[model samples]
Target: MIGPRERVPQAGRRGTRMAEHTGPGRSAVVIGGGLAGMLAVTALRGHFDVVTVVERDRYPADRTFRKGVPQARHLHILLSGGQRALERLLPGTVAALTEAGARRLYLPRDLLTRTPTGWQRRFDERRHPTLSVTRPVLDAVVRERALGAAAGPATRVEVLEATEAVGLTGDARRVTGVTVRARNGDRGAASRVLPADLVVDASGRGSRTPQWYAELGREAPQEVTVDSGLAYATRMYRPTARGEAPDAGVNVPGWPECPRGAAYVPVEDGNWLLTLSGVRGHHPPTDEAEFTAFSATIGDPYVHELLARAEPVSPVHGFRDTCNRRRHYERPGGVPDGFLVLGDANCTFNPVYGQGMSVAALGAVALRDTLDAAGGPGPGVLARAQRAVGRAAEPAWIAAVGADRPYVRGGGAKAGLGERLTTWYLDRLTARAAVDRVVGAAFRDVFCLTAPPSRLMAPRVVLRTVLLPRRPGLPRPPTAVEPA
Candidate 1:
């Protein structure tokens, strides 16, 4: 039997090509042209006759930081799951990233992380590997691939720059379009309305989707926020001949005691993207002197050493808007029929976990499946898509909240006795992960987004955790040694 799919509307802009509209033939309007919006377009490409991406900022071709995405200046890595999804949507996308200087580095082996447990030991290559590069470069590549996939002569993909989506155009039962306002030349000016079969809000953390839905007489989605007031400071450095290794990249994990994190991701053109982050009550310094000193406190000296040697290529860019916020769009009676939310608009994660981009990519994959199930962008499409996307987002939410709660100052309700027991047992599992290959692989599966967190408590994995030694097994932080 054919899986559930959206039924196409009989009268719509892209309705003439009914055969091509196996999912939805009606027009699709996507607000925001970031990575999530682009990938969402790819997911709905064949299903829609006309796909319009509306953006507040004009997109540029070159790999440089721009407005709308202030977080673009920092070091970003695409988890293995996201890499595979992009490849599935647009073939050779990962290769393109590598060609553009993003390293497809293996985890554990290619990574050097100082965890709360201990320094993670070097291990053999696993099933999944992460892609490391500048956020702008990664976005440029994905944007190019997505535009190529969605744009065509007949089934065209249109992008409206300098346009703002202020309100929904449809009623409470079904959304028909949007009320948009383009930026004025200097001051006050009237905006225009754009109609469509479907409207997707990928407008980042600042999205007004909750208010928009309420104004449409729809119920508001339940909000869950875990904010540690995290702050990130990043600067680019020119990579050196000795440190530019194709095999490994430097990483430093955050701890509960320290609540600060750092990373040195190898990017293209012999460059390294350096980032330092601190949680609530322990903010990282943005100035050159303080930035270097902040790196010294992260329980390691490698990042500090590198910062002292590499030439600074960019000014220190700082961001404190990082928070873990989610809208419960999946719950019953939560979403409307004609509108759906994706990416940071739907949920925002702490950037230190590096889960936002990957989760957004996963949401796009779910978008493809949802469109296929619905048969097109039908009136019932919004609610169904919300549930599907929510399911796809579960893994990342669990991993991020679970690991982050311990570090954040009162980020989560105190762990119950059961939770404390579970935490203690899992600590042993993670301790084993520092040395045991099998345990490391199992843990890495969840940590790398290749598997679910449930795997950590599986029967065999739990038994391993129970059998492992009580004492932590990894080495202490590496210290400077005398020259030969």
Candidate 2:
């Protein structure tokens, strides 16, 4: 990794020179050194001779929080789909995470979820497995793996830390590189252009690609948003007694009728994260006393009961940027050639759904696959790759928007006949999923991104979800893994 003082060897305009000349003249630059940017670097291996990552904040030396990622203090999980994608990009990443104190929680089996109906059954189908870990740990491990993978003999990956990308270097027709400057507390540093064949905007939710495009006399990509006005507060805790810790995590999600939710899940270092959430009028409080008291008001009392036996280990942290926003970069003439957008920059889901990181990894995998299919960076390749990244985020986007549409202020627009009917069926399906194993498996498959939404419409799943009697879930959280 290159420090802020180090300069990437550059030559004159249009066609520039790489730091270490080898292979071809191809080079790529990724803006943002977060999880998405690191994975983007891994994907560019072999495809680009030299790949540079520009990051505004210097990464911490250890597994600790940094200003670059404000949500690092919150609970984060890598879903089954994301694990597979990360492993594909950099082999054994999941195992590396687990070895570094990340906990593996099987879906529905190791997680106790309370739907609108009641507490869901603990089904040991073992189809989907998720990793529960602090965001810092996750970022550290993935960053190490991705950087390590990028250090092959074929491709050279350079990380420019404490560097900021100011704008694009090319016209609206095609991006040639990025104009960046050192962010090392120097206000007078002159901006310089780093020429590249491709530029990936992985700057995340704070991306200014739209404004950059406008500066180039091009229209910004169309955007869509679905905000439920959800806000959440999180704090770390450790059980007062070793034996007092629950065997599994608890999640009591909000519904339209209640609109209050809570999740208490175990993380590394014998710590657990308890996050309390609510929409608009019922936002969770950040006060110490009120935070604990609010846990009791959620749909289920199991989390509140667990909190009573746990001692607080960290101050409460609240996050309110829960809106689901998508930039339509895949549409025709939306983005110029040689430029691509992925991760949160393209589609950002409400943090409550826990889909952001997974979607980012999936998008990187799509980028790698698209580049492989196209052979290398060329005319129309970046445009096609951007569309592929968009496709990767579709499942999570649909699920989040559908879930939040009901909570939008003023009820938004009236649903069409098909949407209304689909919503009706989904409500019943969600209720049925809590108790029925078949329905639960189907529902989880889509929720985990391991299967398409059409999985819920399978004949067997549809019959069970439609014809079966609406049975309530277990009245209490099951202490055992499987039903007796």
Give me the candidate number with maximum TM-score.
Answer: 2
**Whole-model lDDT per candidate:** 0.75, 0.85
Worst 10 contiguous positions by lDDT, candidate 2: 8-17
> Whole-model lDDT, candidate 1?
0.75
Model 1, span 234-292: residue lDDT tens: 98887555744334567776666777888887777778888898887778888988888
Residues 1-484 of candidate 2 have per-residue lDDT tens digits of: 2212112211111111223545676889999989999899888888888888888887775578989888787878788988888888989989988988888999898889998888898988788889999998888778777776676766877778788999997898988899999887889999999998889999989999999999888898998877899998999999999699999999998999889999889998899999899998899999999998999888888899898899999999999988988999988887888888988999999888889999999999999998899988767887888888999999888777777777877544444565556667778998999888888988888888889889988999999988989988889998777741
Candidate 2, backbone clash total:
0
lDDT of 2 at 127: 84
lDDT of 2: 0.85
